[model samples]
Target: MAFEYAPAPESRSIVDIKPSYGLFIDGEFVDGHGSAFKSINPATEETLAEIAEADAADVDKAVKAARRAFRTWSRMPGKERSKYLYRIARIIQERSRELAVLESIDNGKPIKESRDVDVPIVAAHFFYYAGWADKLEYAGLGANPQPLGVAGQVIPWNFPLLMLAWKVAPALACGNTVVLKPAETTPLTALLFAEICQQADLPAGVVNIVTGAGDTGQAVVSHPDVDKVAFTGSTGVGKAIARAIAGSDKKATLELGGKAANIVFDDAAIDQAVEGIVGGIFFNQGHVCCAGSRLLVQESVADEVMAKLKRRMGTLRVGDPLDKNTDIGAINSAEQLARIRALAEIGEDEGAERWAPPCELPSAGFWFPPTVFTGVSQAHRIARDEVFGPVLSVLTFRTPSEAIEKANNTPYGLSAGVWTEKGSRILHMANELRAGVVWANTFNKFDPASPFGGYKESGYGREGGRQGLSAYLKAGA
Candidate 1:
């Protein structure tokens, strides 16, 4: 049965682009003289808002505001400071329905995911960190940890509001002010978050939301006054951020891209593995940074597992993101959809068999069929590049060593999944895998308290858990 959801009160899946957008600086929205750009809805290729393109000048303003607020907000008692976060979380819950609709409309994630996963998790993140405000001394790092001051956060479009919570909540808990920039492709939720801040009556200049393309992100990252730069995006951008932060006094944390391997041994539960594989890559149209895009199956059970995966994939419901029963949503953007198609073609040209479940995709929207490629080699472009769409590449391995080798072949080490009935194997593989978060018999698991990040090219630093709070802590405090 398909689930039904009340759409945004406006009921238009796509929001109209305002003539111009204001930069949320110093706790108030201000118009910027810098360039402006249009953010569009991927589901229908319609404009949602005309966002301000912050150049070096605009970033200076937002950073300055954050710096001003940090002097006061950072010194307030932790318990008293937490009240603002509590208010934000409450406002998020109150406006979750609107946020869910906005998220789905802008980012092309299923409404179910935006509602049940993104919205709730975002609220929980604020709520979780709100308690941590006064308890920093018990966070295992030490007593009286001070704020890092003026953090510059750059988030991706995959999970807009959720990523915002992951970045902002802990920063506040640890007493840092933040200047954040959402991806150019998806900025609605962040703008709405600014509204929530207004509703919370959070002090001005404590949290600033800037909207623009890559240059805007660069402005924030390369700014001199920024105490820390936290970014979640592709490995290419992650590398750029690392280099930019290097030789500078700024502290940096990156939650970059991943090409995680979902290893399924022959002894693993085939039924469970089938669902895991589908949910791994197909969830959120496979826009996840830690999405298990690689399926590393033991050769002994490859055929059976592959067959079952195909059968299961056939039953997936792909359609309107606002529809409750949609198992897959549209690709995040037109450029991303084109990239997926190009990569799937590359897989076919490289001699992999390409298959997609028999399904009709939306005609007028950015869409890509859930794709699978078999006979994948380690050297294939499809295997190497980060295809941020609903594409899966399959390969076979005969031994545990080979499984580990294939799983670690990519430069990404954000996450990996192991499926087996053997507890010993799970422990061994978890220890051996270089990924940050290892999933046993599961994939795509997330928590506000679970520290998540990547190793190697997948990027550095942790996003959740006690360790996450430390990112905002001042050094030598």
Candidate 2:
């Protein structure tokens, strides 16, 4: 008999979400001129709050505010700036539980992920960048590196506050004032961050937020005064942003989508490999750009890996995002759920054998069971395309060379994983993988001090560490 867990939902009372939210510009919540959109709880499909949409006019106001703040913020001593960052980081830690709960409610991610992975990393990003504010001269970009005038940032909903941290912390550390836009579906944490900025006594206009959808993002991307743009989302939008700034002088960095291959060699530790594979595809309901959606197993061990994978997947609990025992949560939105379903159908039609763990889904919310498709070939749509959901495609390879070839065949070069006990082969594979970030024997791990990004269509420019700092700085004053 399967074990059952009693429902352990995190209390939502800690976060006092306002009934309606407005755009945060120049350290104030200003009413937006555009129509309001409702933010829903993906777990229950209930409206959580009405969020003000920022149209082009509001985008203009935010950019101007950031540009104005840049003059003063960039002139402040790095030590002073560092203090503000430290304060922001402290505030995030102080209210970590509240932010985690809000994030889970807004993004449909499991509360465990929001509490453990997202919030902690969000605070670490600020803390990591805080130390760099005064020591950037040693960052190999020459002495007295100057700040870009203003940075315009846009983040995705998968890890809302974390992505905001990935963009905002580094920009501020480099002395660049910012105008950040959170994903339309998940804007609460970013707004709450504006409150954190206030608590830190961060100067007005130094960090502005304009909440909205694509149009608002386009306005920020196309704004003439935004010195740099940092975006994390779909490849289609990343390309559009690149085209919009083709002839202009605005610097940009994009951390986009991926179809990463999790290669499992015959000699890998089978149990650990199983755990890694499950974590790679099922974590955060698989709403991850670098999700190991394609599982490549060496032919010698393919059957063993598949059997173990299936059993492990079957044990995953799926349901409420707030449930402490839930392994997989609701899909972020209805549209995203539909996209995942369509792609999964294509996988089935293409002759791949599809299997999902027997799991009951919440009737009202957007949900997809943890699924795996076997007999997936390189040409299979499910293998080639990023499902961006808790769906895994299993493909078999005969040799290490074949694994590398299959892994690099895709247009995405964001991230990849290798599972093997042979140290030499692991190093060899690491050197050959074209991904910007490669993991050996593990998957989906991230750190604030480590630089992360991708090559090719997975998007460009780094988002952390000393390299991340350079994205917002000039060579010399």
Candidate 3:
């Protein structure tokens, strides 16, 4: 007999989402010049709130606000700046339960994930950067490293609050004011964060949020005054941003897409490898940029690993994002769901064998079953491209050299994983994998103290730790 879990939904009462929201500029919520767009809960397709869309003019206003604030904010004593970050971090902790619920409702991730991973990391990022604000002289950026003026930041919907924290914390710690634009689908938490700034008594215009679609982001990036641009999203857009700022002086940092490889050697711990593979590819509905979507198992162990992986995949619970017991929630949007479907279809049409666990999806929401494709080759689209969903492609390697060759075949170089008991092999593989981050016997782990970024078409520039601080600071002359 199969065991069943009781429905345990988190209460939405803690969060009081408003009917409508506007641009957060100069520390105040103000009207946008453009039309409003509705933000919906991806799980149920229910309208959550109407978000004010920022126009080019609105973007200019936000830039001006950040520019004006930068004059006073950049010159403030380092100790004083650190206090505001500490206060923001504390306020986020005090309201974490509320933020987590809102994140689940707005972004369609599991309550467990929003509560455990996203919210905690968001607060920790702020806290970590807070201490750095007072110690930049010791940060090895030379004596009295100067701020880079205004930073234009754009974050994605996958890990909304955490991405916001990642961008905002380091920038502010380095004395740069910002005009940030949250993705259109999930703008609520960012608006709420603006309120947190007000509550922290942060000076007006120190952090500005201009909510909108791509055009608003273009405005911020192309603005003559923005000294720095930091974006986390697709590789195609990262290229566009790079092109837009080609002849300009704006410094840019991009965290883009990946097709990471997870290699399992014959002598590895099979059970632990299965768990790592699942967590790597299925976590966040596989919307992760560095998800281990490509599974490279040793030919000798492929059969055993596949059997165990299929068995484990069957046990995942897929349903309401609010349900504490839910493992996979909804796809972030109808558009993203369509993309996943299209790619899965291509996987089948290209002669790859597709498989999904026996799981019933909720009737109303945008859903895609956790899927895997076997008999995949490096030339196949499913193996080479980023599905950006809960889809994994399995391939076999005869030797370590073959594994390394197949893994680096992709144009992306974001992250990869290796599972084995051999310490020497592990160190050698870690050095050989052409990814910014490598996980040995583990995957998808992140910390605010560690720097994270990518290489080649995956984009460039670090986003955490001391290196992240340099993105907002000028090198000593």
Candidate 4:
């Protein structure tokens, strides 16, 4: 069937983004001292908005506003804070469709995902954390379990709204004012979220948004008033942020890159394994931190598995992001597409055979075909690096031990998926795997309650569940 191009049913063009540049500080939009930069739609190359580039001064101003807000926000009773978070959650629900469309327009993610997965999960994060506001005493984060004051969060372009919720919800729930910088490629939803803050009547400076590239993020990390810094992005940038904050007393949590492994055993439910492998790499066009970029299959079942996987991949619909039926959308930005392509070339140069389903990609938009690399070795760049695209490197293993060895042979330990029929084997692998979020018989399964984060260079701390609250809590009885 040809890929469809139906408009998103709930989409409306109610918001106007004038050719303006500004900072969202103290509950209002104001000009940035820095020069203007264009934020283009990856799917069409349209300049959707010209966002204000944040310089060091803007970052400092935003941090100051957040520090001021923390005085009252951090001191407010837990019950009162809970109400505020709940209000934000309700407002997110009401304006979700608008936010979803904007996310697709700016980020080139399919409307189906932005609507079904991202938007709902973003709101659910707030709702789930909202209930925890007054209940932190029982969350097991030590004595008083108080706020960590002003937190500066830097999020990437992949899941703009969801990432914001992941960082902002917990901070607000624990009574921390936030200064968040959404990625330059996709700042629409975050800017839209600034409006949602007003709708929720969230206090001025409780949530301030600064928009820009790397230099601006550096400013946020180096700012003195930011007590804690949380970031979700590339390992390279995470390293820079870590280095920038090394001398300061400020605490930092990084949710960096990954080259996750999806291991399939011979006895696994082949159908479910096929689905898991497909979903693992294809979800959000594989622009996911925890994307299963590597697939390890038992040699006994490798041929059958690859055949089924090819058939499954052939059915995915990739095109316009606003289309309700799009399975894979355009790459988020030109820079990301270039990165994906460059790494794929490196895969070829490093001696791996690439295979992609015959599908038509958008001509004007930034697109990379969903690719699979065969004849892969543990040392192949495709197998080792975080490609951050819908590219899979397939490697066959003769034994369970070999599979584990190949899976762990990476600098990242963010997520992994295991497929097998044996419960003992599942438990054994789960215990052995070093990744933060492990999925058996499934891949890319996320929840507001499940704790999610990585080990090693893939970064530290957990995002959801009780562990999430710990990041925001101060030890005082």
Task: Report how far off residue 294 is in candidate 4 (Å).
Answer: 0.3
**Model 3 off-target regions past 4 Å?**
none
Tell me each candidate's TM-score. 0.96, 0.99, 0.99, 0.97
- Model 1, position 311, has a per-residue lDDT of 84
Identify the candidate with maximal lDDT: 3
lDDT of 3 by residue, 326-378 (tens): 99989999999999999999999999999999999989989999999999988
lDDT string, candidate 1, 1-477, tens digits: 534444332354344335556889998888876778888878788777788777788899999999999999999999988999999999999888888888898898888898888999999999999999999987766666788889999999899999999999999988899999999988888988998899999999999998888989999999899999999998889898898889988888999888999999999999998898888999999999889999999999999998999888888888888787788888888788888888889889998889998888878889888889998899998888889888999999999999998898888898999999999999999999999999999999888888998899888888888889888885443
Query: Candidate 1's error at 427, in angstroms?
Result: 0.4
- Give me the overall lDDT of model 2: 0.93
Tens digits of per-residue lDDT, candidate 4, 275-326, equal: 9998899899999999999999999999999999998888888888888878
Candidates, ranked, lDDT? 3, 2, 4, 1
The alpha-carbon deviation from the true structure for residue 435 of candidate 1, after best TM-score superposition, in angstroms, is 0.6
Task: Give the lDDT of residue 43 in candidate 3.
Answer: 96
Model 4: lDDT of residue 473: 84
Model 2 clash pairs are none
Cα-based RMSD of the predictions, in order?
2.5, 0.8, 0.8, 1.6
TM-score of candidate 1 on Cα atoms, chains taken together: 0.96
Count of backbone collisions in candidate 4: 0
